[model samples]
Target: MARCFDGNKLVIASHNKGKVREIGELLAPFGVETVSAGDLGLPEPIEDGLTFIANAEIKALAAAKAANLPALADDSGLEVDALDGDPGIYSARWAGPKKDFTVGMEKIHALIKDQDNMAANFTCALTLAWPDGHMESFEGKVFGTLTWPLRGDKGFGYDPMFIPNGHAVTFAEMEPADKHAMSHRADAFKQLIAACFGDNQ
Candidate 1:
């Protein structure tokens, strides 16, 4: 059995505005009030973890401890098969300090431009931590291929270049609600909902 989240307020442990907004939208149906770590002035902990789940837990626990409230965190990245996942965990770091996804995409394109295999995927790990030290976690992935010249002007990060399987348009080209419906984060959120909310979802 998993620990239930009966709390009304949660701290979203993320500095990325887009992530905060997406998560806030996901949690809306649960009627939970969300406050971002940035808003609360919580310091971002070093993501020294080896995996997405580890990093998510680290951030969630850090915020839960600091705020004395339940905290939710997500660590997501793009993994390219051709590069042997070179930027798997370092996806954000590849974007540089300014968090420029354009630079990140350009680097990826440079590496795999000549290669025939442009296969790639997105991975997301979500962690929920309570003030009492209990924690729950989930993970999700969306398989896709890389596109050239970068399409679309929506979605943050490397969305413009990722074309999910069976989809003609990139994530950056889809509506927010449409992307959310089939995103890796949404897959993980479904598992979290199953574990915490049971059938109520």
Candidate 2:
């Protein structure tokens, strides 16, 4: 069985600053030394997978193979039930190459216009890969409804528009600690930490 993260060096296989920051915070308690893909000058790999899990695994594997060390990767996106789960894997590209989520949010809001049911959710899939091709994966989701005109300015991406279930404020309005505690990424990370650490606590 693998040991807990402890204080070992680990690579966060992502170039996005937002994602890297989130993952860094999540790994803080484990005393893990986190490194981003940008730090290593690693190139982003093609994510041609059909599912979040597939994409996450591909990224983790690529990073691990390239660095010859353990790597962690996550693929997450906003999934609108009303849109037939559209923007699932293409969430990043929905706004084109500029990674502008404003256009993507607008598109989603437009699609659900005048609809009574505006249910949606955020899904996250995380993967940890080793240099020997060994790997593990976990998934999490936070259900919520869509909101209009957006709100808050604390978070990036679609955070301004997504109001999590049972909450009055959108993710963008919430503090990082609060959102991290119940976020889809956090949920998935909980599973990963448990699996890796087991009953060692």
Give the Å shift of residue 172 in candidate 2.
0.4
Candidate 1: misplaced stretches above 4 Å?
none
- Worst lDDT run of 10 residues, candidate 1, spans 192-201
- Give the clashing residue pairs of candidate 1, or none: none
lDDT of 1 by residue, 1-201 (tens): 988888889999999999999999999998889999999999999999999999999999999999999999999999999999868889999999999999999999999999999999999999999977789999999999999999998898999999999999999999999999999999999999999976455
Who wins the lDDT comparison? 1
Backbone-clash count (model 1): 0
What C-alpha lDDT, on a 0 to 100 scale, does residue 144 get in candidate 1? 94
